[model samples]
Target: MSAEHLDDIGARLAAARARVAAAEHDAHRAPGSARLLLATKTVPLDGVRSALLADAAARAGDPAAPAPVLVGENRVQELVAKAPHLADLAPEVHLIGPLQSNKVNQALGVAGCVETVDSVALAERLATRCAASGRVLDVLVQVNVSGEETKHGAHPDAAVRTALDVAALDGLRLRGFMTVGARSSDPARVRAGYRLLREIRDEVRDSGEPGAEGAIELSMGMSGDLELAVAEGATIVRVGSAVFGARPL
Candidate 1:
């Protein structure tokens, strides 16, 4: 990448971080409470590397910057392909897309966490794979709060039950709940969906069930709705275009 391109990536990352920090403050949440997860869906390897380098440079220059950088991939193939190349940067990678049962082994090979485990069957598959490999994988229950047929997640009503079942799995650690907010022009509608996820998260945490103790994170929102998500108690926001300047067509 050219120096100008690298500078552009750095600027975009800095802007995204600022947006996250500002959102946290506006919501009266502690600084750095809501972490940003760079969604590298179609980004090329150089672009991803540039973003990581920029993030690292920003944190090194400012000790008070938000927490360490996190990168999320929407495809197992992408994760498998890029993770090895980016291993030297030590980016905390999470599989944020729908994972197939057959691909569990490959997904676990690279992703340290799976954020879209939406079903007990899928959770079981992950657990079986983890058991054989002796690896404990972090997971979040993806809830379709919007009831969007196109979205991949457990229905909002079944989220708690799904979370409980996932928690019982031996090789998985229930980290929290994740949801893609309702796609609507009304911010209230979007915020309502995020708030519901938080409510479900609280219910699970309050249940005192085994493995529910650590299920406190709420990963919601994207570049557009991050403020709403943060206001609704999101601990992590997955951002793409806002940081990467739109994916390639």
Candidate 2:
């Protein structure tokens, strides 16, 4: 890797950290209440490892750095390919892309959490596979708050019901809800999408559904709108380009 490339990555991570800090401060959230998940899709394994190393070094002096969490990947193949090479790092990997039924086992092989579960069928498959392995899988129901036909998430109106059903399944833990913001520069539009997810999260928490009453995570926001997401009560932010520069073509 070129020194310039790594430097670019470092600069991006520093900027991302600054944004997270500023957002947390503005929200009056306790330090580290929100966490950043470095999105690694399309970024090479070496790049991923370098980013983690940089992330660790950046917070080495700060005892209050955010809690340990997984790096997010959009493809199962990427997770499976890079997982062993990055094993010593012990990075928790979360699948943030839409998951197909055929890929459930492959995803479970590496990911600790599935943040883009859009349907009950996919959730049940994940639960069954986890049950067979005698392990529980953490998951977030993805809601299409943007209502864009291109998005892969349950509609907001149907999200609660879907979440309730997913929560009832065995061997799967419903951690919270996740959504992608509108693909616009407008902060108001982006905030609206995140706010919808938070609203759904609040409703699910009080819905008496199993696994819903506990601390439900809101995994919204991305490289572009994470600040807005934090202001809207996002617990986990999936940041990509901002931290890794643009993905390799």
Best by TM-score: 1
Cα lDDT tens digits, model 1, 128-245, are 9899889899999999999989998998889999999999899999999998999899999999999999999999988989999999999999999899999999999999998778
Per-candidate TM-scores read 0.97, 0.95
Instruction: Score candidate 1 by TM-score against the native.
Output: 0.97
**How does model 2 fare in lDDT?**
0.87
Off by over 4 Å in 1: 1-3
Write down the lDDT of every candidate, Cα atoms only. 0.91, 0.87
lDDT of 2 by residue, 1-249 (tens): 577787778778878878988999999998787888988889877778888888778778888777754599898888889999989888888999988888888999899999998999888888888999999998999999988889989998899999999998899988999988898878898898898889999999988867788637999888878889999999998888887677667
- Number of clashes recorded per candidate: 0, 1
Per-candidate RMSD, Å: 1.1, 1.4
Q: Between which residue pairs do clashes occur in model 1?
A: none
Displacement of residue 158 (Cα, Å) in model 2 is 0.7
For model 1, state the Cα shift of residue 108 in Å.
0.5
> CA shift at 37, candidate 1, in angstroms?
0.3
